[model samples]
Target chain A: MAKLKNPRGLEDSQVMKMSYWKILSILLLVYTVTGGFLMEVPRLAIVNETIRSLYFHVPMWFGMVVMFLTSTLYAVRYLKKPGAYFDIISVEFANTGLIFGFLGIVTGMIWANYTWGTPWHGDPKQNGAAVALLIYCAYFVLRGSLENSEQRARLSAVYNIFAFAAMIPLIFIIPRLTSSMHPGSGGNPGFNTYDLDRNMRMVFYPAVIGWILLGVWIATVRIRLRNIEDKILELEYEKNH
Target chain B: MKRIISIAASLGITFTGYAQEPEMADGMRSEGKIYVVVAILAVILFGLVAYLISIDRKVTKLEQRLNDGKPR
Candidate 1:
């Protein structure tokens, strides 16, 4: 790649870091929006055209899970080696994950309302997802209540790992163990049974990647903001002392 | 007359239950309105991406300033 100079004088490292993945994210999403609609889909009775939502709605959950997984890995890294940067990265990833989770729930509800005949069916997956989100919500609460920075980071990193562990069962395992209106649960036919056509897979996989990349992109931006804030605080402390 | 009308409506519902083809937005797609929907959503997605990129650039600029020890 040619080293392009920016008028704003951003270093090559910073400029190049965001170059390829960002462009890929945009392109994949644009393709998702177009292909997701126009592509051939399995025609089922209740789902009907709403099967198209699989492209948009399911990706939110996939993105959320990926974000949370990334957050947890960073949290573990923070535990292994205490550092402000790792803490910031962990927190930002979890924050982005929470946003994706919220979007997933809202979109799920909308899809459920049309197909399942009610917004909240007390379905296992629905309740599981809600509980998982609340667990993560408490993580932020825990972080907010702590007064010391080191203690806050250490405690919250632990809590983040716990939250991710709890989320896996709540969203994935528990839902599958019982009856669920959600596909692939309680012996219900899943996407593989009918809807996972080659055409749909083409758009679906890209959508998942695109959404996950977008979430990571947002998390990285927030991490940068936190770093800047930390630097300013450090500079101020040094000057005062 | 009311009884006859109720019977007809019930029969219609029953027939719909056994309808051969599932209902879909074929009319909308055929009329090209689905493209309109896709276009609007694409525009919104692009707009958000652009905003995020701008923020990313601004953050890079701030980082540069801080690295130079010239924090504005």
Candidate 2:
């Protein structure tokens, strides 16, 4: 609340425009690092030490899903309004989502290497996640192939929406339907069943929020960079003509 | 010595939980092993923040190039 007012007492509308992602992400990073490990966890068999991986690994998937959802929302808007701004936002969100998704896979593999005995076991969730990311990867390839900006935006927007739709079943539904080595799959109970203690929830929730905010902040930065690049290109075109 | 035995017992590696002490992930907590993980994490986090800062600097340079360094 105190940050609402300008420190210089100048009448600047930039006050409301600036985001708090930078500061909050740093704070939450500190909170997650210290609190995540120090807190008590449910003493379950096989996943005793690796339960802490829940804080780091699960948040990546959560952040990726949230960022991809945001990307799809913008893609829909681009289809409706047909604006370059929306396209840029959509692409940046996807880019950030890819980073989170990639990190999710890496962390999951590391966790799995210890818990599941293999990095790339044919778990339904793992296979599903891989397919979802592959779909998103094709979206980027689609964008790069097109030369005309408007056509690229239109086509990519459509593809992005479809990718997000398909990813839902891959990530959430199919994992639950078939057997999975991961928790909360097939007949196994979810962590919530054991986490009635709520010891991990305190840090886990904050970790999710923090990672999502960090993704948004990175996307925002990329969007601004895109805008700058667009402006510079426009200026060069004018000078050449 | 005794701690490993208790941990092994508690995790049902040798015996069961009732026969041993409470199960805690003493892997990172003991013998300053936690500090190694802490250091690795700190370095990774620092590297990411540094990368972000570099991006911020690049953006600032671009803004200055586009706007002649004047406030918009």
Candidate 3:
């Protein structure tokens, strides 16, 4: 690892641009918020009114997985480079992903409660999602326990990779191996089963993209705030020592 | 404030009297109640996004102050 005299990590002109994530976020919000509520959906049993939650709730998992994958990619980069830039990015992505995952679980529980007569039914998919969240929760706890920056980054990066590994089987494979209340798993009527109705597909696809882009926007803001914090810490250290 | 509260209480009770489980509109152009749901969702989403934008602006201001090395 190269020791840098300057610890501040803001140098990219492209990142400082105003039109990048902001405009995209606004456009996506406009499309999603309008289309999600207005779009038509099939009247499925039990989930009649709540089928609209697909646009709002189900997309949260899509956003979470996309953000987590982005975080894992940054973790791999941090392992290779050992830079604060990559570490900042890795942590922010993880943070955003965790928020999305938390929302997903809450929405899913609410949806389940109304439909299945319980908030949690020990379904394979629900259990798998809970475990995946626990793994990431442990990652944050691990980071909080460490004081040294490099050691924290290194250890967290390794744990993040392992967390991602556990996430895949928990979310994808286990759900398929057993009965699940979640759609698209274990013979349930799903997007794949019907490929989604025409109107539903139009809004659903945009909703997923919109939520994922919103997650990215949040992550970038967090990264910027963290960068500012890092700069302040470095300046303070220089002034005192 | 008392009047408003009593009015709100009566409205809530009146709505609950006819309410069914998982109330939903038939389609977009059918009943107008779907528009009410749509409006509520729009308000919630807009409020959330706008709050986030406000935080972003505050952070950007702080970042600018740091870059300029000014207390202001």
| Best candidate, TM-score | 1
Error of 2 at A231 (Å): 0.5
- Highest-scoring model, lDDT: 1
What is candidate 3's lDDT per residue for B7-70, written digit by digit as tens? 4345545544665432356554486666786688788888888888777766776796688786
What value does the lDDT take at residue A10 in candidate 3? 37
Higher-lDDT candidate among 1 and 3? 1
**i-RMS values of the candidates, in order?**
7.9, 7.2, 11.8
Candidate 2 structure lDDT: 0.80
A-chain TM-score, model 1: 0.92
Sorted on DockQ, best first, the list reads 1, 2, 3
TM-score of 1: 0.90
Candidate 3 segments whose C-alpha is farther than 4 A from its true place: A1-17, A187-190, B1-24, B27-31
lDDT per residue as tens, model 1, A1-241: 7766676655576754667888999999999999999888876556778888888888999999999999999999999999999999999999999999999999999999986679999999999999999999999999999999999999999999999999988888887788676875654435543344888888989999999999999999999999999999998999999
Model 3, span A169-189: residue lDDT tens: 898888877766577776443
